[model samples]
Target chain A: MARTAGSSGPRTEEAIRSAGLALIATHGYAAMSLRQLAAEVGIQQGSLYNYFRNKQEFLFDLIRTHMQDLHAALDAALAPEGGDPVERLTRFVEFHVAYHVERPQQVFICYSELRSLEPDNLAAVVAMRRDYERKLSDILDAGRAAGVFRLDDVRMATLAILAMLSGICTWYKPGGRLAKDAVREIFLGMVLALARGEVPAEAVEAAPPPALSRRNGVARAGAA
Target chain B: MARTAGSSGPRTEEAIRSAGLALIATHGYAAMSLRQLAAEVGIQQGSLYNYFRNKQEFLFDLIRTHMQDLHAALDAALAPEGGDPVERLTRFVEFHVAYHVERPQQVFICYSELRSLEPDNLAAVVAMRRDYERKLSDILDAGRAAGVFRLDDVRMATLAILAMLSGICTWYKPGGRLAKDAVREIFLGMVLALARGEVPAEAVEAAPPPALSRRNGVARAGAA
Candidate 1:
């Protein structure tokens, strides 16, 4: 008899990955056991080693694959070289929101389980994260250079924007009040506003905008 | 013989709370043992029962206390009644960034460990979070009514602003390249711009801004 897909090696590996993500996300890394993971995957305890060397490698593989796939998708989604910075940034916001909205589990573990990775593994994940961040930073820089975007600091804006967009995964539920496209549109507006440095007229007149403040180390009012 | 403050009941409770926070932050809620927690606080395992009935209650107490304190602090920090929405929003931004930056561990556990909370505890914490979110929502609503701020959906805007500010706790390090004051200011700009519906002139020209699209359910360009 021909072998079924479910019993095949690749299918088994995928099941292990999915089950591992669910376990780690629920019980966290320190609490999860290979024995439990094996049971969850319907594989013998010893056979689990055929998929990965150990739990640490399994975790590293999960995160690395997520990041790699993200980069590839982002590269494909981003606007072409020499494109308008506004266009590029717009694409970025749209792409980021759409991507993160669908992968809440992966997103949760990626942020929460970073501490579980070993030193070298942690370094690799952080480097990959930085590489991802630089993609947005470059767009912001280009926008600033072109005078299409006004930002006090490109690096800070990159982090802020990523945080703002990635945050949707925390609370967003499918069939919730807002659809994904609505979320994308609203976030896109906010991101563009941020890049363009648009403050309401009242806010602008009431005080010197923080972006315009020249004093380096002196604290702003109410900051204390 | 006089008793040391560290040995006093209140001090001991505080120590337990701190140690519990550290353990849960590192190992997550499910994995952390009460025995380990007691050891960390330098108390007998049975003594932990003196403070809380069980691990679940202990977790709830920590989160509820954090939420209560946040509410009290926010109430104190917000601008006076009938103040300008711009002013009120500014105060909210400043207060949130300052508050969350100091309590990364608490902020982290509040977000990451919500899954571990039992049904009632989770509902209670969620309600507290909603109450907190409404404070910001009211400010945004007032701003829109006064024509000082523009937003498509007040609730979504509230969540976005909170997410953006809370994100600082993840990456912010004291004595880092940017001071807390600088981060507060930069984030303030982004939040205000988001509220004001500020879009770059170039971005506005390149496409119909998402905020302006009249279509309710139809997908936007490139969203597919």
Candidate 2:
């Protein structure tokens, strides 16, 4: 949907979207004003409607576009279907870390601006997120069925993996401590560890049985 | 500092802090108005200053208080020093989950509002966060030294575990699909597994060694 009513229409629309992402990321969506956005985009305030209906619609579009791109990129990055589950998971981890590391602003806005969306838009975005989460959950389910993945709850495992991966955007810098490949390798190790069920040798040895440990003071401390 | 300048002083300050947190959390720090906060707390707009110096100061106070409370609660919940690293890690997961699950708004503001703080306040809050991260990293280092925790990078592992655990607040509801205890148990399992560094048997059998796998087609995909 390029706004190509005129020769400059597509360029202006692209500019508006870029500026809008930056503005809404730095300032919360509620604090952002149409006039300030137009100023940032170097367009007249009244002419902004040519790109989107209003601030609310603009936000909806930004978030929707991010989700769409994310799904498309994920599908392209995923290994062909019917591959081994462990290989599938490894590919998924690498893909997620690479995709999100470069787009911190989009990731931040998609999360922080959900509260600013109206009820219908909120429902739409939430559905898209569930679809994404389901992709990972489906992987875990398949692994469990094949007796390759060990998990008490597949849904919880799915959520934990996604959160750990997505959180990379919060702290990752382009020239920071770890290179991109290093991050991918380290995260893949953790994800595979999570999928496997082996407890550390020391932990296995010193840790009391769950039921007995609970009865002997660990329960009270845990409850607190 | 209790603002007990008069009988109603401390109560009013408490109301202002509580209302400000809700308003800032629902809207954002930049979008929340002092007048709205005063109205929510049922105080005269002009009298809002009895508690804090200005909006910036107020925002700083809200975040600083959250950090302080979190540190204090963690200290109180931790097991006695020199305990088994596995047990310490387990206790940390439980305590963090319980604390943040109930205070979603505070957690949201503490993370999302960091950008709105002035430079000095921002630096202070950031230092607090680093201190918090260091506590977990220290535990991981100790575990590694004891030959119990199997991680290549202690800092990365620490960040991953905290992010996964803190993420419980994003989706948890009082009576959702799983109870709090169940969530805690499942996460504990994941954390302990992460420390153990055990890959699945099937994965090990199907995958090549790290160096060879990187040279093979996996490296190309990872780079992309």
For residues A1-224, could you state the per-residue lDDT of candidate 2 as single tens digits? 44325549788889989999999888778778989998997777888998888889999999999999999988876636767678778767877888888798898788879988999999999999999989888888888898878888899899899889888888888777776666776777788888875653234335533321111100011111
In candidate 1, what are the lDDT values of residues B72-117, reduced to their tens digit? 9999997377678888888889899988888888877888788878
> What is the CAPRI rating of model 1's predicted complex?
acceptable
Q: Which stretches of candidate 1 lie over 4 Å from their true place?
A: A1-6, A31-36, A44-46, A200-224, B1-6, B200-224
Candidate 2 chain A: worst-modelled 10 consecutive residues by lDDT: A212-221
lDDT of 2: 0.78
Q: Which ten-residue region of model 1 chain A has the weakest summed lDDT?
A: A215-224
> On residues A1-224, what C-alpha lDDT tens digit does candidate 1 reach at each position?
34435588988989899999999877777778899998998877788888889889999999999999999988887735546888788778878888888887787788888888899999999999999999999999998999878788888888888888888988888877767777776777778877887653234446533332122111111111
Residue A107 of candidate 1: its Cα lDDT? 78
Give the alpha carbon lDDT tens digit for every residue of B1-224 in model 2. 43334558778888888898889888788778888898898766878887778889999998999999999988888847757777777777778888878888888788888888889999999999999889888878877776667676787899899889887877787889987877777788888888766542335346533222332111112222
Cα displacement (Å) at residue A157, model 2: 1.5
Between which residue pairs do clashes occur in model 1? A193-B198
In candidate 2, which residue pairs clash? Answer: none
